[model samples]
Target: MHSAIPHLIELQRVDHLIVAVRTEIETFPKRVREADAKLSGARTAVAAARERLVNSQKDRKKFELDVQQWKDRAKKYRDQSGAVKTNEAYKALQHEIANAEAEVAKAEDAQLEVMMASEEAERRVRHAEANLKEDETAVTKERKVIETLQAEKKQQLDSLLAERERALAPIPEDLRELYTRIAKRHHGAGLAEARDGQCRGCGMRVLPHTLQELRRDPNEEIYRCESCGLILYTLEPVPVPGSASGSERAASSAVNHS
Candidate 1:
């Protein structure tokens, strides 16, 4: 593996983390809006229910005033009852009072209906208000949780961005430009692991000689995949030592003596 490959890999790691954190942070606004939408809907329901309640109250008041006016008219007709001398006039006066009393009965019935409707409207308003309060509590809690998560993601993104600069500092300018170009072409993935005789990025076969060279410990060659043009790195196997360490030799000597 080339000496620069490790630094490039580190830089790529930081970049990937930065992008992931940014993507997560971006969703916070939409989440807040969704929560707020529920709250807004609850508030609208409460407003509509209150409006209905107010209309019912107005209707009840109108019926009450109508009943009062009819009662007053009936009283006026009764006062004129004793003053009338003719039999037909007295009968007509009594008839007017009866009509006014009937109107009062009708108005009282309508007022009773209006009062019932007003009670139903009050029930609806209470129900809507309860829902609004419940929704507000839930939305407030949800927004707080979202805000906390967003803050954490922002911190992570800030740390990763600073680390990216550190990782990029040691890499040469030309190599950095090459990496940037390739990463842009490949959607922010410029490095690919070469393993199992294949390029992991594009699944293209790696040549045996190039594989052997990458496996070599002291290799300084920077390899790129022919098909996808992505820089490749390989995991070198750990070499087993043929000789024993001092601790092992001491144990072996002890066994021999025993």
Candidate 2:
């Protein structure tokens, strides 16, 4: 056990380092995802504004065409009025001309309304387009930053993984497998320190004899906790204020019958 103690300590250090690396790598993509959502929303707004502008322009064009058609009809009626022979025919021509003029006036008013609406629509489209351009620029910058961060994180992770491989190289195959299995079950914390008569990982009290054996072994080999089956190590035990010593603590507790 004494011969394997250094290897166990090395393994613990490697696991801690890798855990830190994994955490940092996970955060890189979250930043880019947030930026992408913002960019997509901006694009949608721009598309809606452009659609409104197109409809407004179509309306304006139709109204202008109607006004021109009514003006032409009014001219025809005016010419007919001068050539009319009968009084009734002349009166009818005059009435037709008045009706054509009214139509032209109404058409003109419609055209004006459409033109005003078109102008407003165009203004909104331009504003949206500008906003979209700004968002695109921001997205580009954010993507570049994300790429840079990913590259940096990859390099760091590679280095840490290499160190982990080195640390595990000297450990026995069976021990390494046991450690890995425990790590998987315990969310990466395979080993726990027994301090103050307590297993740090699961908060279970360690027996006096178990603590004695752990302290006696100079080479710390892998040892499982009796209660939680977690790997345990003995460092300098921290004395709990007003708590009993190892022998006294053991004597006070009910023995495990099992």
Candidate 3:
């Protein structure tokens, strides 16, 4: 019957929603970050693939230069063979030319290997780039959605705050302060319903005297559960036929006449 009880209950309900909304708002950033991380990983993969392609191209270029140098060496040895007067010198020059040609062939073979690897690297780069773009687009879209949701939640929070202020208006300032403190300590539910002489918040039994006082007191003094420090409230109990305060008990207690 306390004037502040209904307002406190409304305040608790609004606070509960506020806490949930705030918790959801907090997770939005983490969720967006997770999406960004995925996009970043895709970008890294593309970069690695491009680096491999570049290295493979460089290797191919080195091999091509090696082949050109070996071909030039063979050409020089062939020209020197014409100037050689001794048969031994001429044969030696031909042998040198053969070695140079072998070197050129070896270089070409390595160049071909590098070309193949470069092609594979290029393919991977293209695939990774495509994946990166897709991931980036997806993340961007997701972020927009998350941002919209966050804005809506912020608006909702503002409305709830205004509603909470309205709820507090009907409550006495001191009682409102006490309720707010307790609600903060107990996750936005400072009051507990008492049913069948039990504190629902802490599952503790209320004392008989306390229960009687709660039911019979006209002053509307607030009661709190000793175990959990939560304000306790009770609904009016229904009268029974045979129990205490019932018609049957009253009749049995009445003095009988002869």
* CA RMSD per model (angstroms): 5.1, 6.7, 5.6
Q: 1-258 in candidate 1: lDDT tens per residue?
A: 678888999999998888888889999999999999988888999999999999999999999999999999999999999899999999999999999999999999999999999999999999999999999999999999999999999988888989999999998888899899999999899899888889999999999787877777777677888889999888855334553465577789999999
Q: Per-residue lDDT for 1-258 in model 3, tens only?
A: 465776777888898899999999999989888979888789889989999999999999999999999999999999999899999999999999999999999999999999999999999999999999898889899999999999999999999999989988888878887887888888888898878879989899999777766665354577789999888776756444576668666676674531
| Candidate 2 C-alpha lDDT tens digits along 1-258 | 345556767887878888887898898789889989898888899899999999999999998999999999999999778888999999898898899899999999999999999999999989999999999998999899888988988898898788888888988888788888988888787778888889998999998877777777464555689887878877764455566676676766746532
lDDT of each: 0.91, 0.83, 0.87
RMSD of 2: 6.7
lDDT of 1 at 61: 95
| Candidate 2 Cα outliers beyond 4 Å, as residue runs | 219-221, 237-258
Off by over 4 Å in 3: 212-218, 237-258
1 against 2, candidate with superior TM-score: 1
Worst 10 residues of 3 by lDDT: 249-258
Top model number, TM-score: 3
Q: Rank the candidates by TM-score, best first.
A: 3, 1, 2
